[model samples]
Target: MAVRSHSTRVQSFSLSGYHGKPTRGTVTIREFNREQRMRRALEGLGKWWGVALLSVFIPVAHFVLVPSFLLYGMWQLCQRLGTAELATDAHGACPDCGTEQTFELAPRWRAPQPVTCKQCHRGLRLTVPS
Candidate 1:
């Protein structure tokens, strides 16, 4: 097995509410090289395949479980292989409520994404700094 390496950096982002000004924030971005991506894809495949193998022990459920896991593994492998960067963590304050909190971000980093404030339950837009 080849050694897989990845890099991470802190990125600036902004959150805007319908009625409030945009709030500046920071996010942790993880970047994967080709080797890392391949490793991740293979790891995902192996994990799901392991589950599928274990499911074979279950007599009745194996019929559904084995096939489901096998298919899911392939899907995950393709998805991971294509992903180059991911947002792991985000921190910012809600413009509407002025409450500072960590935010949940999607695995694939894309700008102008939609996020909701946990404190105020207000919909906000996350974007990269222009």
Candidate 2:
């Protein structure tokens, strides 16, 4: 057998075929316009800045709002407790003090207990039945 430097094939296929046929050509190379891409990106920086600002602002807004709401909730809780402790039929208030309007707000008494409101000296209504 003799070895030949130039190769030759009998059959040929077009570009779309999956055959291993060979073609002769010098390849062309092209470069990307990177500077143009950079210019385009820089032109859109303002829009990107707005997105960045929103990302930061959203959390900051919630941070401010949540603390304010929490403070308001705590204030309301304090006010409710203060009213429960201080509001009285003692200095001539609360119609149910002497007369039994029904003690719907007081604590439960398991045994015979002497529970009285010091301000009014009137017994509080029992919340739970004995």
Question: What TM-score do all the candidates reach, one by one?
Answer: 0.90, 0.20
How many clashing residue pairs are found in candidate 1?
0
- After superposition, candidate 1 runs with Cα above 4 Å error: 1-4
Q: Write the per-residue lDDT of candidate 2 for residues 72-128, one digit (tens) a residue.
A: 545544433332121112111222333222112222112222234344455532221
Candidate 2: pairs in clash: 89-93, 103-125
Candidate 2 off by > 4 Å: 1-59, 85-130
Predicted candidate 1 versus true structure: per-residue lDDT over 34-89, tens digit per residue: 88899999999999999999999999999999999999999999999998998887
- Top TM-score model: 1
- Candidate 2, run of 10 with poorest lDDT: 9-18
Candidate 1 Cα deviation (angstroms), residue 39: 0.3
